[model samples]
Target: MSDQKDILKNLKTSSIDRRLSIAKASFLAGTRWATSNATSFFSSEKDKEKKRKQVLREQARYLVSEIGKLKGSIVKIGQMMALYGEHFLPREVTEELNTLNNQTIALDWDSIYPHLKNELGSKILDLEIDPNPIGTASLAQVHRAKRKSDNLDIVLKIQYPGVANAIDSDMNLFKQMLKLTHLLPQTREFDQWFEEVREMMHREVDYHLEAQTTQRFAHYLKDDSRYVVPTVIDDYCSSQVLCMTFESGISVNSPDVLTLSQERRNLIGEAALEIAVNELFVWGEMQTDPNFGNYLVRLAEKSDEQDQIVLLDFGAIRQFDKDLLSVAHDLILAGYDHDLDKMVLAMRGYSFFEQIPANIKPDMAKVFLIATEPFSSLKNNPDIPEGIMDEEDRYDWKLSHLHNRVMQRASKSMASRYFSIPPKEFMFISRKFIGAYTFMTVIDAKTNLRNMITRLN
Candidate 1:
């Protein structure tokens, strides 16, 4: 909540300085962890387990705090790991890493002005730019500006001076820090995911790609009145800056959104879900980052107007391969039918699914059924809990508790040996669906999605 001021005159772009900082933090955390293990050796058996978990949490928290202090790609690296490393990282460690703050301390205008001027050049004189940042993040800060000729409102996303160039080195240092603290496992799976994080990091900083993506989404949703995608201003865009017309809206979770009628909320929720479905089934590309900050709900001011969901920030877009998309489509279709045989068949062609034991495939299929419950009619899925679906066949997201049930079933079915890290593509697709599910739950939407899924098929 702090305003942009002189918190950091400049980012520490020097590799030597960042390396030393991470090394020092890792060494201290490592020492504490070693001391805790040595102390646990003399404890009673039952107490040992309890004491060790507590110390692990403490060490994880200490490491995250240190990482939080160094605001740049490293902070983003921690966040990416927290989001995708659930299978490989210790639960306690990932939980602590999740606490790494994304709303970093803002750099002062004096420091930011130079970068803005360099990107905008003489175009900077044509607009009235706000000296204070409207929002701040680890890699960039956003400011509001207006055109002098038309008084048009727009927002500029300005990347930090050297964050992009530092990504590769910062990533290497982050891995070393984890190694020094003995918090992460060194394996092929971890190595592969690490590379994924690196690619996503680079993509996030590429303003040209983000602008094109924004324009792409805008074109796709242009005819849909229920959604709004900001117009990209090409003249104001640069490799380091993205400019788009300012679209006003409230947070999706705002109290004001909850005040709307049930019908209105359902419409809003469905619009959000349709975007996810279209991304997976039609376009084969998705905005993988689902942070609430990227969405805003624009409540209609008049009875004749419709409520709208404003989509923002297209930096984390992930494009899917055709083979993977086909498999994903099969899984959903099989889940809709609640047929274990079809579900098992759909699991073909994916490496992770191929690795699962044949006997356990049925159990995994059941998990898939639970996940796609909202898209199934009561006739197709008779085992759905009573009161979860209404007489009208609407699925109440707030009451379903589907996420927990899926987790429980997956844990009950897959033995430790059979469980493996999913493909990176699956992780992004699943995350997008989960984000949509969360949006519906937050809006208290009771939507009958059977028609939607059937139409897609």
Candidate 2:
């Protein structure tokens, strides 16, 4: 097995053609396995189905391994699919793909120093950089460092050499895969979504923008005690290199977090929900990337404050259409009132429906209402009553069976003829919403989310 893996290692070339070649080989191997397994020699129909699933699981695992080896924008796409593709792809595929979120390998320090030297010049020599990165991702790796002048601990985010340059090629390759995989409906809407993603990817590679965005968020969230946005150090930053005050905490989903008392977990979850609400409704500007790695759970050492959630990575900031908030408010109110007609009108106002069929409109309304059901300020729903929630407020992830319902509704929604992409204006914010919701679920957060939003309004 080691020898077979070594063969794969030898072929881990960064060249686009070589990477695709390896992918093609894996696909063919999966095909062969499926063909060989489909035989009359199987004892029963159940055995055949079991064999097919086993083959699928194997192929999915193999595909994940190969994609991790071919890191770049491809890995970024894989991460998105892992997070958002639950509604689009099979459960087995999504389960395997989600692993990519943490599987990216960083370029070694020997291969990375030159880029740092070029970006920071002699200042690089003055700073003490740790040999190993604390975090590695699709576009960059982060190393802990300290200044010679004051010994102030900081983090250096260094972008890979060709990641920015490879955006176009990577998108082209990803588009080709989409056409072949049928992972999404091949329509103008899908194409538009792809283009939006392409533009966002290109924007993300700009460290300058990330630095600026980080600084801006530091200001917006400075007064908020529950959240921490790292302060960017201007003298140490450049187009390809970002330097900021180092924040120490456990990963949001780390095993360490799961050990926290349920009360603490509820606090963290409430903080997270509030952060999402303020970003969407108050600021109207948001850091759209909600990768689990982007948040750190830090304990406060001060006298007054408790724990704080540290926000990291600001490259994907977006300004949403403020009017959409009003529309969303109306939709929720209508849903709470059980006024399907008003809810449909509000959804149409948000351009959620283009040519949606009449038969599905009622179901669609039901879907919308159920989604906002947790937000009901009405005491009728004992689970989430209207009021300032106590520390005991908790939202159960499994109670509503949201995962299965979302999967079903999304499939039906995409099947609609008039269902194009969601309003382009929400292309990215919707991703943020889904990601934040998932995070809340992961933490087993108990917060009246609607009340959180209500307090702000």
Candidate 3:
């Protein structure tokens, strides 16, 4: 009933800053509770493995509860935490973080009309805007819209207000809380990574940056008719607002999108890989967020051409530099060669220099093979078997083979030594391929992965 209560009650994740603050508060509060009740949070420390599991669960729950409160950008930051925060978090916690989504809240027409007038300085009817949002994400919600003058239909992404402010506050508070809680050490390098993440989160709330990335992607995807990149409405865009013509298409993840003919799926898959490779190797400016839902499969009713592959959301583009670029190439080559020495060497080049136990190298090799096993089967995708081969030849079989090999030799204890890739830029690049591989695995796509490796080499 009071002003303070009202302010707290109205705490919505409109800006990066506000959500960040909430996330910090959540973490700080949760850590205090967990620490105070450390004895109770766990069932028994006598059983080391059970204790370990309980500790991990307690930590993950603590972080997730805190982050879930921040509605917009803060929620996005939590998702990013899932991706890049592995070194600082327990594996179980990381797995839990992966489930965190920045559920976006939709705005009604009355609110949207005002935003359009304010951003466009014209009436809502003056411009064509989709009544329903085609898609949504943590920081911003999107709507399909158009410019009447150009007769263009495009996607309009609008940022929630107060997100940036929330982020700035939350980050500073989180940094200090992390030190007090010892959840993440106060290492200089990791501190730098946190700062970078904070910067990225702030940039995400600025729709203007997003608009530029969209245009840049359009240029990158030029000459590819199968791909549809949105055109930026700079005149109608601002830091908190991004307006672009909506590309008519359905999400590649929509259950129906998958039911498309094999050729259609393969065509889109290949196109996605092409864009991903070009962005990673050539452009160096990578749109790292593969919100699988971001891509839309345009129906043939619009054109007889292959279904147009539309890439949406450019708020999380990561740029790669010379050294990072070279090392990434080395990584791919190493995998293609199945050269354990080269792979270890490349892993080192990328910073995986943690002390390895005497017998762990072989275990790591097995793990690597399992992780890369499917791709190792064929150099060229075209040579890949169309249907699932017998159990031994199936993709799942290869993964199982690799995991089994790893389990056979790798440290069974969590404390056992393990090989890891040092932190760097291509982490997301690895995910892009991994995600693509999963999709391809389902669709039975066989591509000459060797084709790309050969070119890189």
**What lDDT is reached at residue 177 by model 2?**
47
Best model per lDDT: 1
lDDT per residue as tens, model 3, 2-42: 22321223235444555455456656655665665565554
Give the 10-residue window scoring lowest on summed lDDT in candidate 3.
Answer: 1-10
Q: Against the correct fold, how does model 3 do in TM-score?
A: 0.76
**Ten contiguous residues minimizing lDDT sum, candidate 2:** 1-10
Instruction: Identify the runs in model 3 with alpha carbons over 4 angstroms from their true place.
Output: 1-66, 107-116, 123-125, 128-132, 174-189, 301-304, 340-421, 442-444
Instruction: Point out where model 1 deviates above 4 Å.
Output: 1-6, 415-420
Cα error, residue 179 of model 2, in Å, equals: 5.0
RMSD of each: 1.6, 5.0, 5.9
Better of 1 and 3 by lDDT: 1
What TM-score fits each model?
0.96, 0.81, 0.76
How many steric overlaps are in each model, in order?
A: 0, 4, 32
Model 2 misplaced stretches (Cα beyond 4 Å): 1-60, 86-92, 177-186, 254-256, 259-263, 335-341, 357-359, 380-430, 455-457
**What TM-score would candidate 2 get against the native?**
0.81
The CA lDDT of each predicted structure is 0.87, 0.69, 0.61
430-452 in candidate 2: lDDT tens per residue? 67767767886787665556566
Give per-residue CA lDDT, model 1, range 1-457, as digits (tens): 2433536777777888888888899899889889888988988988998987887788889888878777888888898888888878888988998887544677777888998999999999998998778878878888999999999999999998888989999999988888878777988988999999999999999999999999999988888899999999999999999999999999999999988999999989888888888998988899998878889999999999999999989999999989999998898888778787999899998888887788888878888888888877788878889999887778899999988888787778763344457778888887888888899999999988887789867
